[model samples]
Target: MFLLWFLACGLVDAEGEPRIEAHRCAAGYYPENSATGCAKALEAGFGTLEFDLVLTRDDVAVIHHDPFVNPEICTLADGTRLGEEEADRVYFKDITAAEARAGYLCGGIEVEDFPTQALVDEPIMTWAELLDMIEGHPDVYLHIDIKWEGDLSRPPDTYARVVMEEFWARELPNDYYVSAEYPEPLQEVEKLDSSVVTSWSWPSFPDGESTTLVAIGHELQTTLGTEDLVQLANDAKVDELNIPWQVADRRRVEDAVASGLPIQLWTLNTAAGLEAFGKWPVEALITDYPAGDAP
Candidate 1:
């Protein structure tokens, strides 16, 4: 099925359209990181799918954006909704995957940000499960963002090894790249296998105020200059640059492009955003609304 799609419409064609990566598996239309959401994104014609990966206490990698299950999008197995305080205490690193699957059901709640997302009850998926689901879509590309909390998570080497093991075990024909904001995990991946492609994401703020254009622009100007960030990617031997849309100004985009590596701008869901950033020669645009047309 995917082979025919790939042959019919490759990511880039004669028209030179930028490839679309389904961010969090089309989070705007379906539950973020859920299997249903991922399948829908593929069915919707998104060749590349992006999602997050975190490890359980048993060293099993799971498809979850945060280290802890988000209360806003999940409910307890017994049908009780989780509150912020209670959910914060339940870390993936402290529980086994079976315990997580048996203890909680994710999705069904309406996410305030994703107004159009459908409500569906589903279990948290494991890395193996995700691989199995995409088996039929052999040509689909994967953009895996590894998640971990500082000090509270396992060692970077261990985490990287586990993720790599899962990939090796499957040995599927899909083209994929793994990424992390910090360089340690990617560095560990390089050590394990230099052949694997990796990307480095930058400009993450410690104060959690990194979302807006102003804050990200300020950080780029002051502490995390684009030149320096590109040099950091070089030092880490990363194959691509995964940059936030807000900070991907003309200068930063040029700097990343100057590095001769592919640049992927993320989470641009609006037509205005697509129009603004589309002028740049980015390799791909990661978005929650892959089916949205830019006017």
Candidate 2:
């Protein structure tokens, strides 16, 4: 109870609504411009934050989706990318994680999603920094999708769990949800903190670990199929089912609901689809649109 109250104190601010984070602070707009887009998300009363985590050349954690500099947002101010076409020259692999941070201005450094996004020039921060951001806003919950480098040298989930232990050891509030496609990584996360909700990501890997949304026909088996995963999540005390938005019609969504699993569609933008999919109960969703960032 004391912990809860302490956190609640951080939630109250001059503004009545909590600053629920929606999209990553797109690489563009920030406080100087109109705060309408992202700020409105906060104002709309969503208290959970979602963003991608990338490793800098230094191996420091940064908030980015791609392992390489995105051509879509690459600019010359940070580094020489000849043209947007030259983004391939800047593949994150070419540089160490450290160099990646030094090389590019991140987050609001490029084309911004909202006028509210502040242009950040510093290197991407460590996962620790991401946690600190969440901790500061006591009332805010987080839905962080794990970003793997695809090196296959080490499991991405394992690296994340170690950092997560730091958060847990600090007695950080259990207000965030983590999802990953790697089996070993996701399982490792379960060992690290079972109470912290976990989600099975798709495109099932070698061990078939990340296949959260498997075919319905394959669900009724002892094997590690989609059905098994749904049960595993439930047995492991996971909270919801997260699937790609294009997982097909409402009938599938309705079946998932019938099983008592709430659907959380990934990386959606338009509101029209959301309204249409509203027929089924959606526990959460990941969207690029900060305009309607509220859950």
Candidate 3:
């Protein structure tokens, strides 16, 4: 308990800003997403929730990281032949929005298997559903990641318009944020809403990177000094930058702090890594696993 507070207190960015954020509490893991994920994350007292949003063939919102149903968490109704992996057999492409709602088994054979998880028999969540959830939880910060490019094979402005319009309609927490791996799609979001009120994914770093180690490669190429990143984004006139902590350098981290743009590091789940990012200029963080101790 003391350690969490001390670590939290030690975080200071350039100009002495503080950076800290909860990972994917909104997207429950081990048990997959459920009410449990949402409930527990709320209990952990996170300032923001990072969640991935995907679409079904029926055009419904499904909160998942991947396009397929991982067999580790899914099974046939009973007669369908099992495959090497669940993902191989079950895909969002095959499942309609209706089918997703019937029931789902994620990561384990049964919900009871993972007691800590939210085991739900409902279909995957849709965008409207997620938005409604967010509306209800006004206090939580939303770090929404758009998982669809809109056209699947290509891109669609609808992806941004739909989500962004709804966000504005609900007048969700001003602290809430949005990001996307597809910069093109994100550009749409930026164009639609240019206010400085929202938060973004991560910072865009420059230089060159090596593929030697994924992490090392990121450090070499994607990571930059925080200040430089701010200039890059501002010069480009973009709204947000989703950066990986592994790739961010002190200059990049510090610049983000001074600029007042929300900073969120990626995939951090370790105590050491969390502590390290906390010490930087980051304003928020995205981790795969919630430390649960929630700062």
What lDDT does each candidate get? 0.80, 0.51, 0.56
TM-score between model 1 and native: 0.87
The sequence of per-residue lDDT tens digits that candidate 1 reaches over residues 63-95 is: 998878778888898778887884356788889
Q: Please give each candidate's TM-score.
A: 0.87, 0.64, 0.70
**lDDT tens digits, residue span 67-106, model 3:** 5655555555442334754335555655776786564644
lDDT of 2 by residue, 195-214 (tens): 76766655333332444445
- State residue 57's C-alpha deviation in candidate 1, in Å: 0.4
Model 3 gets an lDDT of 0.56
Instruction: Highest lDDT: give the candidate number.
Output: 1
Q: Identify the superior model by TM-score, candidate 1 or candidate 3.
A: 1
How many residue pairs clash per model? Answer: 0, 15, 24
Judged by whole-model lDDT over C-alpha atoms, candidate 2 comes out at 0.51
* Inter-residue clash pairs, candidate 1: none
Cα lDDT, model 1, residue 279: 67
Give the runs in model 1 whose Cα sits over 4 Å from its true position: 1-15, 207-227, 293-295
